[model samples]
Target: MISINNLTFEIGARALYDEANWHIKPGDKAGLIGANGAGKSTLLKLIVGDYAPTSGSISMAKDLKIGYLNQDLLSYHSDKSILHVAMEAFERQNQLHTEIEKLLLKLETDYSDDILNKLSDKQMEFEALDGYSIEFRAHEILAGLGFSEEEQKRPLATFSGGWRMRVMLARILLQTPDILLLDEPTNHLDLPSIKWLETYLQAFEGAIVIVSHDRYFLDRIINKTVESRKGKLTIYAGNYTFYLEEKSLREEIQSNQFKNQQAKIKQEERLIERFRSKASKAKMVQSRIKALDRMEKVDEVDDDNPEVNFSFKFSKPSGRHVVTMENISKSYPNLEILKNTDALIEKGDKIALIGANGKGKSTLLRIVADADNDYEGTSTKGHNVSQTFFAQHQLEALHLENSILQELVAFAPKHTETELRSILGCFLFTGDDVFKKIKVLSGGEKSRVALAKALTADANFLVLDEPTNHLDMASVNILIQALQQYEGTFIVVSHDRYFLENVANKIWYIEDKKIKEYPGTYQEYEAWSAKRVVKAEEPAVKKVKEEPKKVKAAPTEDNKRLLQKKNKELAALEEKIAQQEILVKDLEVELAKEEIYSDAVKLQDHTRRYNSEKASFDKLQADWENLAEEIMELEG
Candidate 1:
């Protein structure tokens, strides 16, 4: 849908993209990956027209629409509710609906052939665009991005910055443009939300170009990979895994080629130096010089510099049971998040806490860490268990006035300056970076500083909440390695499946106000969950088929009682289905109204209720039919 030809973009003196060429065809799901400063976001901005290329051009197909979601939150229309803002994505659909309504009113007031013809045309146009389902689809997109039924009604200003970004994402997804450009789309999402987005993108009928640090998300949603390095773009034909392997092989081959050419050049230069004064070898010397001059020099492959290497060291080991929670019940006002949940964290256990947003994953983590004592639970720390909790907003606790070096030193006052500097270096802060004030650092940089300070806190147990939110791939890899080597118990709440799969040995899933412990890696848990879902669904189908057999056997008192009960159920089911169908119809009518669609919260609630009622109505109608057949056979 979009094409970049010889695109050269620069920021001041530094050239980010030099003569880079890339093509995004229709339905292409491409992942844009690079190191932290490799201009992945900048490339996205270039495509979205936020940045103009210094040279060359980017061209798009005629009349193509584009949806761009940047890392920052979009603050326009902040007074509107989340649902209302998201519904705005369907501007064309809304406009068509308005025109259709106007035409209907005109036809009703003054009947004429022209009015009738215009009304018919508008109705056809509306149906062609599926305008009737606009509000429903908008709600689905918002809910998938982690907005609750109640929260969808609240104004955008009420939500945190992270959640506001999710609203922006929902808007972009609902737009359904010809092409999508997303930068770090999953940075603010929980595990369930990420999974929902993954499913949504998998079925999206548009070309997608995403710049993200999430390896697993990329693997699941993208079919192609575009990598940026040293002002050039390289395309890989497969997913993130394929890109990694292919890039490695290409780099190795290039390194060898460069080495061979260097060897040949040295040999030629040596021969030229020796034969310069020899008159007998003049022709050979000239030939070799010409060959050397004509040969194109192969550029040496540049390896990634500033590789972060560090390991966590516990000051002391905790007891076998590092932390324990029993009979835990947490509630806020009318809502009960967790109830009677029990968990045990043994020494050296790496646990990943996962759940949908607002399902209390972070709450449970905080309760165990003693960060929040306002809960009905018995949580205890084992002997000699020194705990450090890294909240999602822990970076805010850092002194913004202090430099990176000052922050680390404050965490470990006794450590020498050189020791602290070495630790900061391991976190990718080195030389001038260490002296940079924390206030000017970006969110990712602040996260790095906070993590570096936490590693020096000498704690044997850690409770981390979304620790990898702002980390790049390399930084996340480093943290995974360090945490793997740490001889301590830790519970982490993270959405990065790749990071969790590498670090977690146990998965604690929270859903329906209960915590289920799965003693396996994340991949294994996924497999188990899939099987469980299938097994749970099998018995429902079997029961429906088997129940009718008993009613057809004989006409005893027990059988008669059963038959009467079935008849009563059938009548009730018919009434219920009728009522639900009416509700569904009413909801559809309400959704078609401009006033209702403009109110986001109402749209979401009505949409959900409509879907729920429609599903129940269908199931009840099927059961009623089956029971009616059974009654007829029994009476005969």
Candidate 2:
């Protein structure tokens, strides 16, 4: 647990926090949220002792372990494999394993009671640390974070900056520290990887404090919300949705109070001015003036809302089918990512391309956009279907030496300077900001510029990949609104669920080297996928029952061996079932703890895990019984 008391942190002329008090208890999962440069990341740094407070103090248990994932990717040894870097999280466990190996070597030569005792102690420590499963868990985590088995074996230097950041995140997750401070953990993750992180954090036993722009991620994982604004911290006892509702109400009430106080002060001032020249009401005037002096002025709330307004202009309308692809296939030298995939994009269809990382979503988008024409496919753009493609690295493609104004002028040289400045202002860049060089802009600013250029390109179709990666919540909302109002067909590959839910009317799910189109929103697509999973499992259950009825021959020697194998498997399954049951019981006990139950999100997660473990135990028990019956019949 960590506590901050009257924490005051300032940087030069700006005070980010002033006499702020906050406490993060054990099992607390809080989302730190605010606009860009609103001190969310600064608070994380303060907690990690990287930034000392200007006044007051931050206190925590001396033995508390903290793990922090910074926005920037950490540097790793070039020669070390990605897996090797991740396994460093379990340094102590790995050391114990090494000690165990050395002791075994010693025992082979000359063993003594003292040496044997030491080996026993080390083995116990290793087992307690779950050393046997460390490698497997490490690999599983790496795979979840989008690292292939081959990629895991590759040296860290071979990965891109985004992949390197994922490796850093994996290491922090594996550390399982008492407290986790994550800044933009989902910035580099795809939708599937983000979901994996959500599930993993749900099961984490410690506290979490994360600063992320992904609203859907925060809603699923965080139980509490802490907002930083105007040198103050406000805590919400619920998730992002709850915070929004509460903040709205609070803002309305505060606005009303401020207006009423201003009105009363104005009336008193008028009375004082009028009566100051008259002796008939000297006492009342003095008293009113005293009250005015004693009154605390309510500071007006600053409007932090982003004002973005823009519309796409096209030269001409496209055909009913914006794009069509037949038997599209793409392959690299080492791997085939897409195989005979077919897709159709109709006019005005807003499609969200979603899948796991490296699953060819971007490749398919590129193919459709004509950015890459080497793929084997019959890809054709419909008549008058002018298109603009915004890749994930589109911002990086901007000329760093050019000013923001110059960048837009380069895109549309025919537009007047006044018109260009007006367009820039619509995207939240105005006056001096328009003159700032592209190299000096932040990631969000650069993304806005790129998007502004794309929207103004006079194209009827847009192919955008990961356009929301570096955008903050406000910018993402603005982009969503802009895209919604555009009268053009577009295909977007993004991991922001909130953005997708608002802007996308269709879902193009990429899996197993194929594209499946679903005519619904992202939430509806999720429901459809869940139903498909359930339907798929039903057939497996039915096949398991039907297979036993078809066996009619007497047991042979091979059957005996199979039966023995089944028996051993059954025994192992039963042991696993017992262990799982114990875990479920322990979780139940944890659920009974007052602190755990008080937090609704944490309680729901525990209950869900308990049910899941219970279900697995039941399935294993059923398998054991089925095997037992099969063995008995064979024996007879």
Candidate 3:
């Protein structure tokens, strides 16, 4: 548990936090959210004591352990295997293991009772700490984070930066500290790994503070939302969805109060001026002036979600079909990305390419973009097609010597300074910000510049790879809006489901070295994917043949009547069960709404209704199952 008391932290002239207070209690799951420059990551570092506050203090519960997973861990390397690296979290157990080994070696020589007793004590402690199974636990976590058993045996230095980050995440998880501080842990993960981490974090008993741009991850894992804005921390009682709703309501109320206070102040000011010359009202005017001076002014609400007003339209539209690939096969040593797979991308397609890391989503993207000619494939672009490819690596393509404005201006000579600046404004580079050199910009800022340049292309089809990387939620939303408004074909690879759901109309994934398409929105794809899993688990219904005639005569007729009655009952109960299911769902949704949460009585009432409906639905399901089994018995 940690408490931040009136924390005021500054960097030179700018205050990143001003009198911000937040209490991270045991078992609390909090999502730290804000725009790019709001110091979300800085707050995390301050909590971990990596940075000291300019004023005020941060206190933590004594002897509390903390496990932190951050991007900086990408630089960490060791000759030890990933499994060994992860198992290093068990410090006491590892020390005990070494001592036990020494004792066993000594026993082989001396065979003394003292050494035997020491060995016994060490073994007892090891077993108590579950030391022997630490390797298994480490392997399981590594695998969940997208490492193979064979890969886990490989040295940590052999992996890339992203993979190394996953290894660090595994180590932190193995540590199982009292509080876990994760900064964009989902950035390196694919969909499956993200889901695995979500499940693992949900079951984690310790407090968690996560600063992630992935709102989908925040919605699922964090129960509390903390918005870092204007040097202050605002807490939301629920997840991201609830925060959005509650924030809108709060802004509205604050806006009205601010308006009312302004009106009242104006009225009092007039009265003060009118009575200033009159001796009889001097005391009253003095009191009013003092009251007005001492009044705490309400700050106006800030619009965090800025609109992308700049229009982005390519000059040309491609033919109906965009990209076609046939007989595609890509192999790298022991791995095959695609094997004789065919893919078709038509015009007006907004595709979200997703899946695990090793699935070769990037390989397919390269093939589509004509960036890789080494793979075995027949790839063709549509007639009159013009395309632009955007990736994180493209950030380096920008002219560091040039300002943001100069970079775009040189890239698109056809567009005037006014037009270029307009686009830059949409990318959050307004006025003097456009004069900032590309070399001085943050990663997220440079990413925005690169994205803006990509949109300025005269191309009709766009290929984007993890475009949301290094971007805050606001910038991601801007990209989403720009893409949504653009009437062109594009395919983007991203693990941010919320962005994918909003910007993409089709979902594509790699399976068996083939590109697979799901012709629906991300939410629909999620539902269908889950339903497919459920369907796979369902038992196949066995067709019951006509009941074989039994030797019993009087009982047979009664059995037929009983079976018929039960069949009717089952049908009726099923119909009722279907309606009850809807009722329960409606009540559940109602209970989750912001309005219900704002009112205790409404929440309680809706919860009671939901529970009652759920209980009745369960009872109906039970009755149906029992009756169906009886009817089956009667049939036999």
Candidate 4:
């Protein structure tokens, strides 16, 4: 738990947070949200004591344990494997294990009482810590963070930067600190990995404060939203969706108050003007003027709504077939990235390509965009397709010396400088910002410039690879809305589930050496994918008819043996049949239920149960007939 009292942090002339009082209680799953420069990450750093506040103090519990994972991880170059790096979370336990092993060797060499006593004490201490489960727990966290079993054994130095970040995440997740601070935690995670993280954090018994631009991830993982804006913080009691709705309502109230204040100020001004012309009413006018001077206006939150109205106008629609891919296969040495992948982009079709990290979704996108021609693929563009692609490494690979305006002009049409500057302003760059060199731009600022360039490509087909990276939720939503309304073919590879759900009319799932399409939204694709995974994991066995086991009648004088045995077995069978009947009835009722019909599993279960019950009924009837025949034979 941490508390901030009267905190004010200023960067240059601008105040990031001013007089902000906040407390994060134990087990609080809070989300830090704001615009790019609104200082969400800076506030997180303050709590973690990486950066001290300009004024006021941050207080924490005595001996508080905190773990913070920033996007910028100091490179960890060592001989340690990824598993060993993650296992460092239990370094003490690991050391204890080593000591225990040493003690075992000593016990064989020397039978002295002192050595035996020391070994016994060490063993007891190690057992108290539950040291044996440390390796298993570390592996679980690593797997959840998307590290394969094989990759865990590989040297950490072999991993790329993104995978290194995941290794860091895995370590943090395994640490289980009292206070967990995460900055854009889900940025490098795939859908499966993100889902795993949600499950991990949901059950995590610690305080969590996360800063993420992924709306769907925030909505699923966070219970509270702590929004930072213009030197203030406002806490919303709910998920991101609830925050959006509640914030809108709060803004409407503030706007109404602003309007009423303006009206009152205008009325006071008119009254003062009217009386100022008369000598008799001069004292009353001066008194009212003094009152007006002393009155402080109600603070209305600054609305950035106008800055968000970005409109992208393309030159014109292109031919029917915007792009095409056939038998695409890409490989990097031993890594067979993508194999026999094929896709088509018809004009005005919005498609989303999705998969786990290292699954070659981006590779497929690059092949389609012709950015990587060293692949076996026939990627064809239709007449007037004029393709433009945004890659994941675009920001880092840009000409840093070029100013923001220069970058735009470099990509935009030769004579469209004026129009390009206007477009840049819509994305929150103007005046001096446009003149600022790219070398000085932050990760987010560079992303905005890249987006502006992508928008002005004058192309009907868009191949975007993680374009939403470094963008805030508002900007991502605005882009999604624009794409939804755009009259062009779009193919994007992204981990942001919410964005995909909104904009994707078709989904391409790259999995298990093949590319598959789902004719629906991301939610539908998720359901089908989950079911497919479940099916894959399920035991492959044909369930055959199981003969019922029989128990002999107990011989007791207090009861009729034959009758009691028959009754007991009958009752047991009846209960089972009743349960099955209940299930059948529920299925029938649900068949009439529209909601249940939409779920594939429920429908499948219903049909399977219906057939199973019919077979059970036949078997039960035959058993009854056989039992009756035996009874009559015994009676005769």
Candidate 5:
């Protein structure tokens, strides 16, 4: 647990936090969020004692253990194996083992009482530490992070940056510290590995604080939200989606209050002015003047909202078909990344291209975009179907000294200066902002400028790679709205589930060296994938042929069939017990409502019924486990 009180952190003239009070209770799973440079990370560091606040204090639990994983600290040495690095988490246990070995050597040389006593104490300590399980835990974590048995033993130096990140994640998970501080933890994780992490966190006994841009990850993992903005922290009691709705509503209320106060002040001023202008009402005028002087001014609430507006429009195409890809195959030396992949893009199709990293998602996009025309594919555009590829690396395209407006003008359509300025205004780059040199702009600003140029191209087909990376939620939503209203084909690669759910009409999942398409939204794809994963984890059943029944079928047959039915019923009862735990919690909360309190007798009855059901369920679960053991032994 950590507590922050009246904290105000600042650097130079800028205030990151002002008189902020924040806390993370024990076992709390919280998502920290804000626009870029909002001090979310700074607050985390303050809690960890890495940075001192400008004023106030941070209090943490005594002897508390913490594990932190920042995005850039994922470097791994080439010589160390993945398993070797993960095993280092249990260095204490390893040291104990070494001591035990030394004690064994000492015991062999002498049978002295001191040697025997030391060896006995060493053995006890080793067993208490669960030293034997250290290797098992390392393997489990490495595999969970997607490292195969052979790959785990491979030198870490041979792996790329993404794999190195995975190794770092494995090490952190294996450490199992009391509190986890993860910043963009899912950046290097594939879908399956992310799911594995979700399960691990659900069962973890400690606390978690995550900073992520992935909305679905926040929704599934976090129970609370901490947002930093305008030199303050705002706490919300739910997931990312819930926080968004509540924050918007709160902002609207603040805006309304400010408007009402301004109107009341104007009315009071008018009354005071009229009274002062009348010579016959001199006393009243003096009284009004005193009242105005004594009146406490209602200060307008500051706008903490960070919404960036963006608009994009494209020219209507001459035809319906946007792009067509046939037999796309890409390979590097001995590795065939893509094999005979084909896809067709029709007008107005909002497609999401997704996959595990390195599974040819980007390669497939490049093939479609015709960046690598040497691929074994024929990609064609329909008549008047102009296409544009907005790479994630578009910031590298801008040269030094070109103003933002000038850069766009070079690629923008021939139009009046007023028309170009109006287009720039839609994206929040107006007046003075338009004159800033492109080389001086921030990552997000450059992204918006790149987007403006793409729109100005009037391309009917847009292929975007990670378009939502630098944009904040407001800008992302604006882009989504524009895309929804646009009459063009769109293909985008993104990790933001909420954005994909809102914009994608279909999903193309690249997995296991192939591309597969799912009809419907991201939620549908998740649901479908969940069923597959659950089924795979389930025990496989092998059907046996039924014995032919005679008029007086063997008496043993009836007994065997009845026993099987009983076993199935027992299993169902055990499952019911697991379900009831969740159901009882819900009912307990529901029965405490005011409406239920109005009927005390009914509430008492329901409570008693729930208690009875729970007792029976628990007893059934115990019996089921015993019966399963007996059945397994008998069958063997």
Candidate 6:
């Protein structure tokens, strides 16, 4: 557990955090969110003591351990296997094991009692630390992060920067720190890896503070939200979605109060101005002035979400079919990506291709875009269809010397400078920002520039791969809006579910070396997949549950057949119970007759018959209740 109090941090003249306060309790899963450069990542660094706070203090439990995963860890290099790197989290255990090995060697040479005793003590400590199973634990965490067994055994220096980031993440997880501070933890993870991490974090006993733009990941993992805005930290009781709703409502109230306060001050000032010369109202004016001065000013809500006012248009509309693939098959050495897969893309179809890594999602996108032709397939475009491929490689395609505006101008020759700048504005590069050179921009800025260029192209069919990567929440929202308004067909491959759900009307996935389509939103696809998995495993689970019932004897047996029989008997007994009640009522009516009351014999006979019927009805009701209970239990 850690606590941040009155944290005021500054870089030269700029205050990154001003009087910010946030408390991370044990078992808390918190999402730290904000716009770009709002200091979410900086706050994480402050927590881990990478930078000293300008003022205030951070308090933590003395024995509390913190594991931080950040982009800077990408520079870490090592020749040791990834497994060894991950298992390094057990530092004490590793040292103990080394000592034990040395003692064993010394005993082999000297056969001394001191060496044997030292080895025994070291072995006891190692066993207590569970050093023997550390490798297994490290392997499990690495695999969950999408590392294969062989890859885990390979040297860490052989992996790319993104894969190295995953290794750092794995090491942090293996450490089992008391609190985890993760900055964009899902950035390097694919969809399946993201899901696996979600499950792992859900079960993690330690607290977590995640700074990420992945809304879906935040919603699935975090129970609380801490929004960094205007150099202050504000806490919400629930996840990202809840924070949005609660913030909207709070802003509405604040805006109203601010308006009302302004009106009151205006009225007071007018009275003061008109009554300055009048002696009678002087005291009232002064009182009103003091009240206005004492009142706390309410701040107006900032407009965080900006609409993408620009529209995407192409010169020619595509035919009914935008793209078609027949008998498509792609493979690599020792890996089969796609096998005779057939898929078609119709005009106006916004398909989201999703799945785990190594499933050929990007490969399939390349094939559709005609960027890769080595595969055996027939890929074609419809008449009048113009294609544009937007990928991470697009970042590489941008000229570093060119400004954002110049880049757009080169891509879209027909659009005027004013028109191109308008599109750039929607991507958050406004005014002078459009003139900034591509070389000066950050990774996220470059991505936005690439996306702006992609939109500038007059293409009727768009193939976007990981379009939301390196984008902030606001940038992702802008892209979603742009895609929503675009009339052309597009297929986007992204791991962000919120982005996919908002933009796509169809879902595509690869399974069993074939392409599959689900004609619904990402939310619908998730629900269907969940039920499908349950149904797939239900047969085996149901068989295990039914085996005992099938072999039981008649008394204990409550199989389907016996359950049905009980249900039938309960139904029949209810009818008899109903008739018995009517019979008892009829007997009561006869006993109440005037003639029967006057004659002793008739009255006695009628009373006795009524009593007999009532007793019979009571017994019948009791039997029905007992049978119903038995049936209920048997069914339960």
Tell me, by lDDT, which candidate is best: 3
Q: Kindly list the per-residue Cα lDDT of model 3 for residues 1-636, writing each as its tens digit.
A: 799999999999999999999998775789999989899989989988999999999999789999988788888979999899999999999999999999988988988889999999999999999999999899899989999989989999999898999999999999989899999999889999999998687656678999999998988778789999999999998999989999999999999999999999999999999999999999999999999999999988878888776576677778998999899998999888899989899999999998889889898898899999988869999888999999899998988999999998888888889999889888888879999999999999999999999999887899999999999988899999999988889999999898999998999998766788999999999999999896773322222234455564344787878877887887787678778877887886775455654444555576667668888888877776777788767766
Question: Which lDDT value does model 1 have at 512?
Answer: 71
Q: Distance from true position, residue 453, model 3, in Å?
A: 0.5
lDDT of 3 at 231: 92
lDDT, candidate 2, residue 91?
93
Each candidate's lDDT (Cα)? 0.83, 0.85, 0.88, 0.79, 0.76, 0.87
Deviation from native of the Cα of residue 26 in model 1, angstroms:
2.1
After best superposition, candidate 1 residue 430: deviation in angstroms? 4.1
Q: List clash counts for every candidate, in order.
A: 0, 0, 0, 0, 1, 0
Steric clash pairs (candidate 1): none
Q: What ranking emerges by TM-score with the best candidate at the front?
A: 2, 3, 4, 1, 6, 5
RMSD each, Å: 8.6, 5.1, 7.5, 9.5, 6.8, 16.0
- TM-scores, each model vs. reference: 0.83, 0.87, 0.84, 0.83, 0.80, 0.82
The TM-score between candidate 4 and the true structure equals 0.83
Better of 2 and 6 by lDDT: 6
Q: Please give the range of 10 consecutive residues that has the lowest summed lDDT in model 4.
A: 538-547
Task: Supply candidate 1's per-residue lDDT for 471.
Answer: 88
Q: Please identify model 4 stretches exceeding 4 Å from their true place.
A: 305-316, 414-418, 533-636
What lDDT score goes with residue 225 in model 2?
95
Model 1 per-residue lDDT tens digits across residues 382-433:
9999988887578989999998998888888867788789878777776889
Q: Write the per-residue lDDT of candidate 2 for residues 1-636, one digit (tens) a residue.
A: 898999999899889898989999987889999988788888888888888999999999999999999964555546799898899999999899999999999999777998899999999999999999998989999999988888899988888778899999998888889888999998888877998898778767788999999999998778889998877889999889989899888888888889999999888888899999999899999999888888888866555565556645777999999898999888999879878988899998999999877778878888988888898879998988999999757877999999999999999876778877877777678789899999988888898899889888889999998888778787787788789889989999998999999999999977778888999999999999989986774423335556656546677998889888877886787677668777877986886554665465777787788888878877876876787677667655
Q: Which stretches of candidate 1 lie over 4 Å from their true place?
A: 103-109, 112-114, 148-153, 269-295, 305-309, 414-419, 430-432, 539-636
